[model samples]
Every structure is written in C-alpha cells, then in structure tokens.
Target chain A: MNALLNKEMRLSASILSYLFIGFGLMTLLPGYPILCGVFFVTLGLFQSFQSAREANDIVFSALLPVAKHDVVKGKYQFSMLIELSAFLLMALITLLRMTVLADSSVYLQNALMNANPFFLGVALLIFGLFNAVFIGGFFKTAYNFGKPFVSYIIVCFLTICAAEALHHVPGLQALNAFGFDHFALQMLLLLGGALLYAALTWLSYKKACENFEKIDL
Target chain B: MSIVELKDVCKTYPAFRLHDVSFSLESGKITGFIGRNGAGKTTTIKSMLNLIHTDGGEISYFGMPLSGHETEIKQRIGYSTGTVSWYPRKTIRQIVDVTRTFYRSWDEDAYRKYMTLFGLDESKKPMELSEGMKVKFNLLLALSHRAEVLILDEPTSGLDPFSRDELLGLFQTLREHGVTILFSTHITSDLERCADNIIYISQGEIRAECSKADFLKNYGNPGETLEEIFLRLEREAKS
Candidate 1:
C-alpha cells in the first residue's frame, strides 16, 4: 500500500493544490476543503490519463504481485490521506490566525472557537464526498470513451454543487443550544456522505475492475 | 511442462478484438512474442494478468489456471508492457518503494544493485528523466523483484546501445539463474541474442512458434535477422 503512494504523485499535486490553497488563504475562499476537492479531482484525472493514455498502469502494474482490488484500494487510501492532511493543515492555519496571527478580536475568536467543530467537520465531509465522486467517476470514464461524459457532468455536480449544497438544506429548524444543530447537521452529512461515498467508490472500482477483466490484459 | 498457457482467450469490442488466442511459454525457456503494432501482444499480456477480462478462455501461469490465483500467478511473473511509463512526477526511489510493497519476495539488494548498475539516480523524478532512463527504471523495478517468469514487451526500446547490451547481458544472467522470460521487440538483434524460443504473433493471433535453433535452422542463413523474418511475414500477411 505504501509502495504505491510512495509514487511522486504528491509533489506535483501538492504543489498545484497548495497553490490554490495559498490563493484561497490570501482571499479567504474556503480554500482548504474545496481546494483539496480540486486536488483529488486533479489527481484522479491525472491517474486516469496515466492508466489510459500512457498505459503506465498497463505495463508497470498489470503484472505486479498485487490484486486488481488492492490497486484501486491503494489509490483510494492515498487520496483519503491527502484529504485528511489538507484538512488538518487548514484547521491549524485557521487556529493560528485566530489565536496569534490575527488581532484577537473577542467576538471573532468566540465565533471561530465555537464553530470550530462544525467547520472542521464540514470540510472533512466535503473533501470525502468530492474525492469519492471524482476518483470513482474518472476511472469509469477512462475505461471507456462512450457516454461517460454524462457521468463526468454528474460527478462535477455532486462534487461542487449538490454535495456542497447539502449544508444549506432546510432542516436547520431542529436547533440545539450551542450553535443551531451544528453537530447534528454535520453528523448527518458526514454519515450519509460516507455511506454514499462508500457505495459510489465501490461501484466505480468494481466497474473498472470488472471492465479490466474483460479486456486483453 | 508449459510455464504459461493461454487457451481460447477471446474478447471483442467496437474497435478491437482478440480472437481465441492460444499459446504457451515453457518452463526454463525464454520466449519472444513477436507482433506488429496493435497485434494483440499487449492484449494477451493484460488478459493473462486478468488486468482485462477474457470473454472465452482460460489462462494458466505455472500450470495453475489464472482465474482465482491472479495475485499468486502475478508474483511468479515479472512483466513489462510493450509500452510503459512511470507516473511523471515520481523519482526512481519512489517507484521502487511503491513496487516493493506488493511483492513479498522483493530483494532490496537486487533493487539497489540494479539502480547503481543502471546508473539511475535514485532521487531523479521520472518527469525529469529521459525516455531511456524511464525505461531502465521500469525494468529495474520489474527485475529487482525476484520472480520465476519475466513477461517483457519491447523491453529494449528507447535504450542506448551500451545500456541495451548491458541489459541484454543481464537478461542472460537472469536466464542462467533460471528465470523464464517472454519478450517482444522490433529489435531482432536483442531477441536473437537473448530469446530461447519465439512466438510470432500478427493480427491478433499466433503466426509462428519455434525454438531459436529452429528459427536459425529454418531461415537457412546466418546473416538473416529476426527483423527480416518479421518484415517478410508482415509483407506476406499484407499480400
């Protein structure tokens, strides 16, 4: 598992993603999660090219002592690790800015500290769901050039639009003392996001793997 | 006994197809799968790995059907694609590190030795290296893991003359060490130098199969190259 991720993939991607994040930091555009969302999406697209065009995968790994499932699974794990790492880095940055870097505005500090869990949870949820759709859909598209464009559009919708919009759903009427069902909403999104991601991840992986078996090598 | 076997492996698609392809690679013998561009060499290798599915046929590696024992079969087989590359941003060290995790029999000594022998910088990113170096690194990764069978596609392509000779010599040494290799190349000299048996494939099927000795004997001229034979066959097929 470590062998595959040890791939220099991180540097180019990290550079690209952090470049965006740095821009986000400068502009305060919720850079951490969505930027990571972009990162995973880019990684998936890149890997799809690696597997499809160069057939780097066709030659390098097709005969290595690894299972088809493990190969897909390895990519999945690596993407998750990247997402988690990105999220924590952002959280720390947010924390540092609030406590030390920025002037300690009492009102701002209280709001940030109170909303910390909600923001962190939301970012993680966003990253997970986006990674799932992009990674899953990209490979599925790579294996065939047919109508996967529809899927591509759908994945984009899920990642940027539908998935992100869940936070704004009308269920906020169920309130708690601290911050208006913040924990409940996050848990709902996270758990539901996880299950949906799991299913989509597997389907995409299985589709690719089974599709693999039917082709030449 | 046959070291590898393909029986009735057929898959059809809108733009391409591999018909009931059947062939065998013998234990302790080197085999060359000769093919023109798009002649199903890559397909066969991919199907054998179960990297792609076969519509109808069974593949066996080391006498066991490749159906359920895919990983184990792959463990014994050291394969390289006719066309292959590394992730663009990866260093040789990173590629090796990633490959090391999968093979239980990975030999660090072999890996390090090949790295030094190939004059490959461990830290150089794949994107920065030339095509030849990338090929060398790919071969190094596949070879460093000790396995009984080597499935190589166009293994010598993009190599400098010196590196190509040295690598061919390395193949001979591995053969002496009891590795059975399958290779494909337009470079007849490399195949003529190293292969023990040859399987000529053209147009998604096996065109000819024979030992290196028989090839030499039947061609009836010491100077005639495998390239000549391949071109002759390809032209004949075209006609």
Candidate 2:
C-alpha cells in the first residue's frame, strides 16, 4: 500500500507540477462511468510513462519478487483513486458552473443536460475506462501497439461518440438522474467501475505473466 | 543441495528458443554462467524469476519448485541485467523509491550507500547516464538489496576497468558475507578474479561446469583459457 501511495504521490506531484489540467478536467464528471473513463486514461498515461522508462514494464516487473497480478491490482487501484479524486474536483466545479444556469430546479436546461456533470461522468466512464484500457492492455501485452497515435486517437474519438449515443437511451440515462444527494448510487457506480477495472487488470496480468516466462529478456 | 536448479527447461517462440538446458548453482559460491550473446543467460534468469513460462522440466530455487514458493524464494534473491533502460525523466532516487515497495527486505540505507559509492547522480535520469554508468547503476541497485543470492546476467558487460574492479571488490566483499553471487560474463579475467565456479554454456546446453580453481589446476592454465574445450564438448554432444 505504501508503495502504491508513494508512486501515486510521485506521479501526482509531477502531474500537478505540469499543470495537466485535462487530467484535472477528466476527474470532474459526476457519473461513475465517466469518472472511471478519466481514471483509465490516467492509467494509460502512467503506463506510457512506464513504457518510456522501461522498454518492457512486464519483464522488469516480473523480475521483482512481486507477483504479476498484485502489481496490476496496485496499478488499477491507483488509477481508480486518481479517477475518484478527479471526479470529485470536477463535480465541485460543475456544481459551481451549474449555479450559473437560470431555472435549473424546474427542469434541467437542455444545454446543461448535454454537459451535465452527472451525464458527462457516465459518458467519460464508458468511453475512457472500457475502451482505453482494453486497447492499452492489448498493446502492452502484445509488446507493441498497432499504430500508436492513430489507433489511440481514433479509438478515443469513437468511444466518446459511442458513449454520447448511449447517454440518449431512456433506460440507461435514468441511472445518472439519481440527483445530488443519493450518495449510495454514486458509490455503486464507482464500485462497479472498480470491479470491472480489477477484473481486466487480473486478466492482463495473467497474460503478461504467461508471456513473460516465455519472453527472451 | 542446489540453491538454484533447472532441469531440461524449454521455452519456445517463433524466433527465439531456449532448449532443454540444465544447470545448478550450489550454495555459498559464485557460479559464472558464461555464454555469448543469445546464449540464453537472460532466458535462464527469467525462468528462475518466473518471468517466462517453461514448457518442460523443473526449476527449483531455494529448495522449492518455482511455482511452489515464489514469494519466499524471490525475496531472498537479487537479480540484475546489463540491459538497463528507464523512464527518461525519472531520477535514480525515484526509481529506488519505486523498487523499495515490492521486497519485504528492502535495504533503503544500502541503496543510498551504493548510489553514492558508484558516484551515480541519484538526482539524474537513468537514460542520461552513459552505457557503462547505466550498467553500474543497475549493478549497484542489485547489490544494495538485502538478498541472500545474487543472480546477475552480464553484470559487468559494459563497465570500465576501474568500475569493473570496483564491482569485483564489491562482489568479493559480498561473497565474504556468504551472499552467493551468480553472474554470467564473457570476461574470463573478471571471472578469474572472483568466480569460484563456472558454467560454460554453448548452443543451448551447459558444455562445461566445474570449480574455476580446480579446472585451472588440471588444465595447466588459469581458468580454462581456450574456447576449444567448450567447442569440442559441444561438437561431441551433437555427434
């Protein structure tokens, strides 16, 4: 836990120093899925940093006494924590921004619904967490990305559009309407994202470990 | 009992293949795994660490199959390689901080001591260092870890003579403490200065393995001077 926290601190300090406000914006969504999306993007960035540092993160990590899965678990959890923090910060900003809207209580302004903290969070979560992590995991395990920048950008844009489409669905959109005070709903969303991230993390770890054993370092 | 043992371990891929190689390093000694580039030194080390999957045979470390007691065994073992790469922006100190998290017996003070001893700028990025310094830095990192066994693959592959001597001196001190250093190197003189035993590998097989001193005593040369012995043995095995 200390290691995870320490790495987080180190990373957060560096990110903070860089004034990476996009990452900061990513956290602001109120919906759980969007928050998860922002979190996974953050993890993708972190893994990129690791890949830059060590040509092979899996190989170097396997060299440690640490099991492959635990390492992945630690990284995924850290991503979630960062996401949670980002979303909280963003939610506060959105709440402040929401106050600017005239007559929000009667019916949410159509414009605000489009950019609503709650809905935006859901959108980002689906787009960022699910899409980014799967592609990143594929590249990471395969020891190479298909096209790097082109693939990532295309995927990011497509996922954002898909999440936006999903938001218009009457059934799914209602889940995010559990307005301000229903803290339990918010927790559940985050927990669901966490569980999904954890599951993916375990699968990626196993694949990488199996690959590491056969890898000629 | 063998402190590190691998019997007929095989790992295969499209381009790379680690055949059924077998060797063991007994406790309380240095075992030099000498192989040229692509001779499977790193492959063998990776297998010991469970970094790769072996298709055939058993690999026992610290008296247990690798799958049996990985954590307990790995914690007691130190591993390093000549191939060192790092995040271009992270400093040596930051890397050390990252490494400290996994091991139960992380020697922070020793880590700092080695950082200073090597004259490595703890504040500088690993990628910024020269190749020799990079290798040295990695070596120092391995040395500082409070592991009972050291498994170094080409530990001194790119060091200057002075740094090489410094590393040998460090290894000598470690051996005195019964640390059991196992390093693979092509530098025969480096092995002559420190290794108690040698495992000469060729064509995916351990062609020769014996005490450095005894082999030299019988061969009438210091530490099996000629490559012909290994070549001949390899040929004999094939025929």
Q: Which prediction has the highest DockQ against the true structure?
A: 1
Considering the two chains of model 2, state its CAPRI-style docking category: acceptable
lDDT of 1 at A51: 42
What does candidate 2's lDDT look like per residue over B178-221, in tens digits? 88878887776788788888887766666667887665665434
With candidate 2 superimposed using the best TM-score fit, by how many Å does residue B209's alpha carbon deviate from the native? 2.9
| Runs of candidate 1 exceeding 4 Å displacement | A1-63, A84-132, A143-172, A175-217, B81-83, B216-226
C-alpha displacement of A202 in model 2, angstroms? 7.4
Q: Every model's DockQ, to 2 decimals?
A: 0.40, 0.39
Chain B structural similarity as TM-score, candidate 2: 0.88
For each candidate in turn, the TM-score is: 0.75, 0.77
Residues A110-142 of candidate 1 have per-residue lDDT tens digits of 311222334444455555444445555545533
Task: Pick out the ten consecutive residues of candidate 2 chain B with the lowest summed lDDT.
Answer: B219-228
Tell me the interface RMSD of every candidate, in Å.
Answer: 3.6, 3.5
